[model samples]
Target: MPRLVIVFDEFAEFKGRHPEESKRLIGIARQGRSLGVHLILATQNIEAAVDPEILQNSTFRICLRVGQAQDSLQMIGIPDAVNLARGRAYFRAQARQQFQGAYCGGPHGKRGESVSPRGIIWVRRDGARREINLPGWADGRGHGEPEPPQYTEAQAIVERIQQAARYLRIRRPALVWPDPLPPRLHLPEILARHFQGGWDGARWSVCRPLRAQARQIAEIQPLIGMCDDPARQQQVLLQLDPERGGHNLLMFGSAGTGKSTLLRTLVSAIAHTRSPDSAHIYVLDFGGSSALKPLESFPHVGAVVTRFEDERVVRLIRFIQDEVSRRDALLRREAVDNYRDLNARRAPSERLPAIFLIIDGFGEFKRLAPAELVRSVGALLGGGVAVGLHVIVSANLQADVPNAIFANIGLRLTFSQADQSEYFRIVGRPSEARLRQDIESPPPPGRGLLRGTPPLEFQAALPSRGDSDEEQATQLSLAAQAMSAAWKGPRPPKIRALPFLVTPTAMVEAAQSVAQTDRADLLVPLGLDFDTLTPLAVDLAEDGPGFLVAGTGPQSGKTTLLRTWVLGLGAQPSHDRLHFLFLDFHTRTLAAFRRLPHQNAYVGSAAGLDKALAALDEEVARRKAQLESMYEAADGDFDSGQVIRGWPHIMVVV
Candidate 1:
């Protein structure tokens, strides 16, 4: 272990202000020698006030120019210091010695030689004095004063010592403090530093394999930011290790504190490190600013849902839940304990990509979302990590986050909080020194304290090269677009959603295809299934002999759904056998269906509606009579399983 040294420049004032600290220093001085810990205490004229214990334990002492002989005697047991000139001091150990301290202010050059009025005088080896006339030296005084010796500043000398130490492979004492973190760290610069190879045109020709795919779990840590360890004098790359640092992350900060920007940078880092097949990102931007909207262009991003997208937000949460369930089943079936094991056993092409679910403005989401949804998120945070599902949630305040959810998250980041109490609550109480330092100088945006083995302070990298939000957003978009265009790997499975508009012709084709494959009594294609993205069809004869198409508000798809059903029915070969009656209260809505050969009657007026109903009743009575006559012909034992081919199915749209 390196030796420790504690220095007190003005011991008298420090002792006056902090009596306890002075006592502690005395204790350290007593035991420090055996423990390789040393203390240097300095005072000008207050040597008599110094603690006797400190003086007794101190192995060496130095006394510079003192005010009185008594002060010199008190310091080094000698009066020599009183007569000492500036830059001169007396050291007292086994014996007293005088020495001149080097000046640390600045360098000094050799003084020019002074000359006599006639010339400079030179003393020859033969003991003969010769006066040499030099124009510049021929002033007045004889071969004047000798030139002063050149002096090197203490700083330069120390620098040279440091250079020599490095060359000699000698270790230096640890720094008392680390350098302050930079105000800004661009993502491109960080990526370039860590990853090998540069852009080959627009594509990154990576020379190093991705950390996500590393064979060892320890080596799979992904870089997030740069961490500053002041005590250790180290500025190391801050990586989130899944094996050691739990998967879920919770970040707390005030608005515009770079919470969203840090999330964006994390996504960008993942994209640069992992292929679309290896990882996927799903963002729920409840922040309302669509801060993560630009990430939608990345091939690795499966979805980016904003606050305005109410349905999409719900769907996105459901999607994540479904993914968890899917991974659970997959791992059980494969006899794997976790995703990492599953990936190791399976081929790269067969591996399931890791899912990163980032919920921005989680406080707002918790407030608006249903209790069940919030609970579902909590459950995900608890068990999702085992299956390669990582959830990162950020909130503006600690109160907005539930303790149940907060406890499950392992990695935590706290940005500039509104108060010291909030910061302490998020990352636990820091040391007094840390509190004093941080409270005096609050961190700026993008600067945060990360909770780990030893809490570290880090500066998050920017997602783009630009400083302004607009420029960063634009640059992020362009980068995403470029990556999407250049990517040759398979993209993440897209979230299934119904198209806004489906043409009647397309519906007809879909229905016809379904009819040829599987014969249903009466199947009509409705639309696409939300979960599977497959064509969804309703088996009218199986699921419902009678069905009602209903919705709230105008143009709520009631008319469109009814029209799609009618069109789909008409596309089937059995359409000729089917009969449709259109009761068009709003004539224009169902007018097109009246031209179909399957249509029995098209009634719009009130008088026509009654007649249409009476005619339909008469037809029902006729069909009943025909079925009864057939039963009588068969000796009252009609074949129950046999199909009645003469009867045509009647469908009504109202």
Candidate 2:
């Protein structure tokens, strides 16, 4: 018990007489914490006798009636210890305190007549008290030591461990297996003991037991399905290990052969077997299947693209390609061989997960995806594996999957392809159509053949789903909420909003407001720019060149643009400050502004255009002469000054 104390009254005298005794006491002090030994050493010469190591590890220290101030300071780090009165001590342990002992009883006091330390008239609490020996003053008193504590099973075990000096620490060496013997010493018990035969079971028909020792080794990658090998049972797994080849995979099968289901199963396996750190799935549901929808809720999944729009797919592919390039540059800069090495060395925030691109319905995707997307997909398949990019493509027809992509694909899974040429192209073996004559019906869904040294048959497992889309969506949303709540990493990059669409009318209204102010000089407001949604304006005098609005077809906002400029300029309060000459090949376009007072002239056809041109040329010459006369008279450049009379800025539109 920690309360039990073993006191040594004169440790300095004993140590001075026997030096080995002091060494033994020091050793016990060092190891006695683990054991149940508590030592209380009282000495007059503490600095000369006590070891520094013993003092350092001591939990409790008491300074009582030290003779010298320096001795008190050395013992308890304070000179106040020398001022301690008789029978008074300064106690220091977890905290410091000054303690005064309570008076037990006077020397001449008798049992029931004497006051106890707590000032209580002494009366034994125990009904049955024995005559225990105390100091001669209280000899007649029945004083007994408190009974030793009764320990529970757990406390007894702890006490037993604490009391022991040193425990027997066992350090076992690694077990090494010996070579198996030949079949001449046939022993089924040895094989059963080693393998614990179940999935590792295989018949050794005429084999030597030395070469046929069963070993239970788990599949490294997640199991896709169980291979149908007659001799031995093995699982078909999808692996992204570079040593096994690139991670890209291709699946070709006809309709209703579970190609889509297999993809869903693969995604489910990936989500379960690998953590979010290991893999990030992106499901491109080209055929618009709800199978991939549930995966959107998985923390490991980045997105599920159900829309088959070409532009959206193009953008997504470009984003992935850019990411690939970024990772490549990072790897090159870090001098790493692969993504795994780079990820291990990089900081947690900078680390990249293996990106698995699961694309379903290759035929449908090809029909809608642009050329850029196709090229990006090819590049990802060919080069992205080294940078932790894995692709799984599922196609209904063999021809739909590009032959060029076949070179990069590591694994090819085929299911019920009716065409022999398609089967041959995918599996690289001639199909045995006549052999299937024994079967009357079609192969079941998810039943497929894996192409290898010797082709293996397997059944792909499908992930469980909710009964209805609403339930599935609810479950997904709830799961996503939970995942987001649990996530502690750096937040994902914020999604940028597409440029806000600005209508032509809004632009015209803005321009009209600008025209009301004097600061609006030659402001021809075109509709918002496609890239930035900001007002696309051209200051004819400040910004060089004139407006050229071109498009492939009619009513493509070209005419609307010209009308906005004309209306905005005409809306100006100072009508003579800016002039407008409207010329239209198709005269109906500028009909909205025909009645406006700001018009210099409205011309249509070649003859009207010639007349308008002649008028504008004469006006320019007249303005030039007026400006020259003003310059000579004023001896200053009047062109740089405010608007001159009858020399307005002209805006011509065709």
Candidate 3:
């Protein structure tokens, strides 16, 4: 749509008298660019005709044919543009938009110098446009554009400095300036605004090429050969932002490409950020123990390992679904929706470290006898991310899995795999195609091609040999033991748990050893609970027989329970008074007895519990006495005599 149009309106009133008509023509040419127009006013007038403003904006000006070189100086100064052939005009140093056609050195300009006349321009996209106006050499480093009245003065001086520096490579001693400043510091922030330009040996140089590309913001700190070299390791890493939103990245490389290693370092940097609401990365280690196995003991890791439990798994699924629902609701409610906000609004229930689930060997998920894992993958794709859930599923597929999975798994990392087709499916096509066949040839131990965006935006230091797996394990085990020991402190003479969660104030610790005399005053009926005693209790809340017991606590009626721990179901006259027990220590010196309304009674003891012969001994003795009594009396039913048999005895202690 940018077409060339020249306005000769001011020159229309061509008066030979040379009144003020010339001045008007120059003004129209100078201001036209601001209004989206460019003017080339060709005139054969003197100083009285041209306006200063009009001439200042003229990036190019020339004379078709003038009286003398002096007259040409008015248009181009120093070397008169009019001296050249009629159509072979030379370039003139001018400011502003419009250019008067003139022949120079190169195809665009001269061999030594190239002038864009109207600053410089660059395209962002297919058909986008932008003009660059940079400040001093180090835009906004030391000196910046002044405001209002001072702004005009600053603009003129800056351009003069630029031209002087360009034309004369050495600082122009010819044109002495009242002011001088040091070189500017270069940064992305300084380049986005105004710019500075100068004439170099054969051409002018402008820092901002005005070439449109991606917008970037980085408050870069000084580094030892940092921007120049990215492969070098940096101790302190900071990520520079590209554009406004976060970049979804993909990583593709062979094994030992340091994908997991680099991801760890990046995670460390993110943890050190001062931004309160920054979104954190959730690493999903789907590569067995090798991928995220090391993360099992790391703090701040939301590591989840799969276990075999049909019901428990269902519950976990429900929990994941609920988490997704909650995050979706939060997104809808918040005015400023971003990962940062959702992170801040995390509910107390969601405060279990982070909610990241590192599902190892995702392929194995389908192999397990589960129903429709592929369908479940859909939910994982939809709301898994926003809820602070990140998944790093590993597959040998060259390209990414499916569009849906690929979309959700914005960040991709590929370990070494032979199949290019699979890699293409796992990652994108470009990366897979490039590294597919190459991976099969056996890359160097710790080297491979890299794809996807660079995180940590830097490199991580290699660990020394001293940090080997066995050494690390030993250190960790020692530390855990030390911590546990410290918590336990000195051992008590007796470990005593009470009948309830509360440790009874009545309880006292003994110094040395407490014998049987120590428990002489122990009550007949007592309660055994968590605090005073490490009583094993079943969790009514959980299905199956899940019982927990810790160290010893206060002893109570454990012996009583051990005594009558067995009986046939429904054979007992009293079930409420009965219990079950496994004989270990402390099940001696006690007899349990339960009597019915009749004089006959049911009795059990630790000694009798171990034998069917003992039950037979007691029953046989009673039956023998009953038989003798029946003979002494007459005929009678089995009571304390005859063969009195109700049910067989089941021994629990045995």
Identify the leading candidate in terms of lDDT: 1
- Candidate 1, TM-score vs. the true structure? 0.76
Better of 1 and 3 by TM-score: 1
Q: Considering lDDT, which of the candidate structures 1 and 2 is the better prediction for this target?
A: 1
| Candidate number with the higher TM-score (2 or 3) | 2
* Over 4 Å off, model 3: 1-259, 266-291, 304-322, 325-339, 342-354, 364-378, 398-404, 413-417, 422-654
The root-mean-square deviation over C-alpha atoms between each candidate and the true structure, in angstroms, is 8.6, 30.2, 20.9
Indicate the TM-score of model 2: 0.46
Q: Model 2: which ten-residue window has the lowest total lDDT? A: 199-208
**What lDDT does each candidate get?**
0.75, 0.61, 0.39
Q: Estimate, for each residue in 28-101, the C-alpha lDDT of model 3 and write its tens digit.
A: 65566566667666555645445566666777664554667766667666544545555555444443222334
Q: By the lDDT metric, which is better: model 1 or model 3?
A: 1
lDDT of 1 by residue, 364-416 (tens): 89888888888889988767878988888999888889889988787888887
- By TM-score, the candidates rank as 1, 2, 3
Model 3, C-alpha of 192: deviation from truth (Å): 25
Backbone clashes, candidate 3:
52
lDDT of 2 at 326: 91
